[model samples]
Target: MREPVRLEISVAGHAGHVFASREGDGGSVPASGPAVVLIHGIGVSHRYLRRLHRLLAGSVDTYSIDLPGFGATPRPANTLSIAAHARYILSAMEQLGVPEFVLVGHSMGTQFATEAALQAPPGRISNLVLMGPVVDPKRGTVAQQALALGRDCLLHESPSSNALVFTDYLRCGPVWYLKNLRLMMEYPMEQKITGVRAPVLVVRGANDPVADADWSRRLAGLAGRGQLQQVQGTGHVVQHNRALEVRDGILAFAGLGAAAGGEPLPGNPT
Candidate 1:
């Protein structure tokens, strides 16, 4: 049901693709309101995000991306850091002519989202959504994180979800995966998020082993303006299986519902 990204964009030589609202894409370019941009975790691409992107795009302009070195995008000559990746994302969105947008990230993508929100110019990023955030400080080592991911795949994720993930992993290959694994393990998500000015929404599946409940709550409490939501009967890929739930949380956080299009929730200050 997902279509190929019709455009390829680059920033500082790092190229990536974006699937967004455009003519012939079933949705027109968003004229107003904050756009939604989805970022995927390592070893995966926009394929897994397609469902959520579709759900969000129906109400507001939305985008799902394939970052450089993953999916169809060509790999970079060298591995880039979290900040460099964030820079690529922001620069590419600017090229898309997006003035302000909401950033939604899953798993390791949370790291990139946090950095992007922090790095964006004041008022550019309206909200930050981190679903199934990763690298719990107490269990931050590769072995522990791998164990949690394996447990999640075996116990929580569905067969179709497993298929999408493993296929993306195969495309990512072990070399590029291992090259960035260190950064994912070392990046302090909790610490980095503390500096983000945008309101943060931390979401995790109640059953997700990768992102412990306590950790998600902690990250929310650390942010200047943050909140946590857990979707029941789901896991690490919460947004995929519980797309509607994710959509509700995002729309509520953005104050889109209960108040017609592009307005703050009644009585709640934006």
Candidate 2:
């Protein structure tokens, strides 16, 4: 696989980093398809999404962004709202000359994706994918979310997944994570989903305590064009471990059947 090109971009006075990679003999994606952009959850960075980025890169152009305050990007003077983060992403994409593409977000990133879809110009975003979307209003409190996260890490997540997440959390530091966690919990995801114009694919790990089945299904149903798929034996960080399955689901949802191939859906183990 070819190494992703690192880019430093500034949007609205906030600097961010993006790692872009393409498939094919010379790292070129076919012009026929829209590019795929991946956004990671809160307190983490593109590292968690890298597995999925690589998997999808074989068939489409892929870019994973490190939003300001996470990863190597420096935190801005003010805490940004979900909508602000979306604007930063849109601005960065605009600067990069990405006129149209598929936008995929996981956990808190889903909130950012939803806002971006609403704000993007007509036809600028072809599809939106939300993986393990956040703040199931039923468990919307910070304490509840923390408990769910702990439960997910203890019972559902793999050791490697735990390492990646906790390490990123350390990098993010407690103060930043808590600030963003509050923002994530306050966002009205269900209400916002109804406003998105693009088709939406809501995906989750079968055992993801963070984004349970009922919430995921309800989220998908809220969209004008929406569908849900579950990856078995995975947790909140599904894309990191079950990347192939997630990639196939994304391709199939985007109507790229040849790229998706005939991979059978993973069954939920009893």
Backbone clashes in each candidate structure, one number apiece?
0, 0
Please report, as a residue range, the 10-residue window in candidate 1 with the lowest summed lDDT: 259-268
Across residues 159-253, which tens digit of lDDT does each residue of candidate 2 receive? 88899999999999999988998899889998888888888888899999989988888888788788888898988999997999999999888
In model 2, the runs with Cα more than 4 Å from the true position are 23-32, 258-270
| TM-score, every prediction | 0.92, 0.92
In lDDT terms, which candidate is top? 2
CA lDDT, every prediction? 0.84, 0.86
| Deviation in Å, model 2, residue 264 alpha carbon | 16
Candidate 1's C-alpha runs over 4 A off are 1-5, 22-28, 258-270
| Tens digits of per-residue lDDT for model 1, 150-209 | 999999998888999999999999999999888898898877877888888888889999
Error of 1 at 222 (Å): 0.3
Output the lDDT of residue 90, model 1: 95
